[model samples]
Target: MSKFKYLIDGIVKNNPTFVLVLGMCPTLATTTSAVNGMGMGLATMAVLLCSNMVISLLAPVIPNKVRIPCYIVVIAAFVTVVQLVMQAYTPGLYETLGIFIPLIVVNCIVLGRAEAFANKHSVLESALDGLGIGIGFTLALTCIGLVREVLGNLSAFENKFSSSDGMLVFVLAPGAFLVLGYLMVLFNKLKDRKKKA
Candidate 1:
């Protein structure tokens, strides 16, 4: 049950993107398409997993004063690896993702988990935390991307399913914000209703 708490934290209570709303830059910018969303999510997931593992292993050795720096170094190392590997193998995605990929080093989601959860937890716990948070982030991004693509660009939903112009708001950058904001409001309302019932 304790392990599952990580899931709750990442998905509902402490989401890196929507709930806590960290990493807004990429959340707003890279979510123009489903492809870009997946690319960013996968890249971020890799960095989170590796950093969490490293932090868990070094939890004992990482000093209290220099803990932040140590966690960052570990996270940055994984981000660099993800950047290089993506550049070599998925040049198209790398190009599309652009500077956001490099920005993973500073992304609060990855570093936040490292410091708040991973460093204080056992290796298994840290790994689970990383996975949960990573998945939550990916899910949120994908939803945002889908809405943006379908509403901002008519081709987004139609291209995947049938052949018709759906709407253009889903593709534009402004549409992402609009959709996300509404979604957040809806989620909050739903949560409140559940609490009262």
Candidate 2:
């Protein structure tokens, strides 16, 4: 039950998006469409999962003075794997994500997990944390992408419901901020209500 809490905490309480508010760059940039958002989210998840387990296994041997660098090297290795896999099989998404794919190395969510949770926890716990946080992040991105695509492109999952554009601004950078802000508010309200109950 204690181990499972690590998983649940990430998805709801410590969500990288709405709660902790980590990884804002990719959260905003890669979510222009649901496909792109999911692609990025999955790629990040893969890296996070692999890196977390590896970091947990290696934490004991890593010297305290250089733990950060060691963690980053582990993360970068996983990110490279994800990038190569995406480029080979999903070239379109690979192209769409562009530099952001490589930029996952610096994403606060991944690194923060490594330093904060993975290093201190067992491999199974770390893996759960990574998976839960990854799922939360993916859901957040997908929801934002869905909203943006539906409103901005007048489509859902690329299916056009209206011949005319919905709201062009929702597809732009400004729209990303607006949607994120609104969603943050909504999430907080729901969580607040849940707490009150």
Candidate 3:
């Protein structure tokens, strides 16, 4: 496949969130608001990009037996950097994201890309793949967050539209699953329609 295909595929065809259904913890937990969702997505993207490139570069020398451990170390390193930076700069978002931030080290999307794509692809290709997947994940979280916020809070990005709550359920755990299920169906339908066309 071409380099650009790596990028586009993640955003639409092989989206981590909507398509692959990876990273559900952060997706469901942090997306109570658009800003929180976007923040978590961007943080994951940063880790993915860096880890993919590093893993791709180190693939040749990494022993097969130790590869998984090495990958974790690399991912953990980047995650620590992200955690510290977020803690220092965006303390509120940092707090909101909380444990989910560090958990990116174990995120399936990140690790799966490292093992499945990064280890085999060139550095550039791996980076692009990471970026594509990251963008896709970001968009999915943002959309879910937007929907939940608008419906539950009667607001967008925490901006209040009215004094009264819209649908309290949407702001809670159950609402994440509800919104995700509907969005997943909607996305799949679109994909199927495009394929038929």
Task: Return the top candidate by lDDT.
Answer: 3
The C-alpha stretches of model 1 lying farther than 4 A from their native spots are 156-170
Clashing pairs in 2: none
Q: Give the better candidate number (1 or 3) by lDDT.
A: 3
Among these predictions, the greatest TM-score belongs to 2
Tens-digit lDDT track for model 2 on 43-80?
A: 98999999999999999999999999999898999899
Better of 1 and 3 by TM-score: 3
What candidate 3 gets wrong by more than 4 Å, as runs, is none
What's the TM for model 1? 0.89
lDDT (10s digit) by residue, model 1, range 1-197: 97789766777677777678887778888988777887788788888888898899998986799999888888888888999999999999899889999899888888888878888889888888888788888888877787777665644523665466656666676677888898789878988999999
- Shift of residue 11 alpha carbon in model 1, Å: 2.3
Q: Could you tell me the lDDT of residue 108 within candidate 1?
A: 84
Superior by TM-score: candidate 1 or candidate 2: 2
- Estimate candidate 1's alpha-carbon lDDT, on a 0 to 1 scale: 0.81
lDDT of each: 0.81, 0.94, 0.94
Q: Candidate 3 on 77-102: residue-level lDDT in tens?
A: 99999999999999999998899999
Prediction 2 TM-score vs. true: 0.98
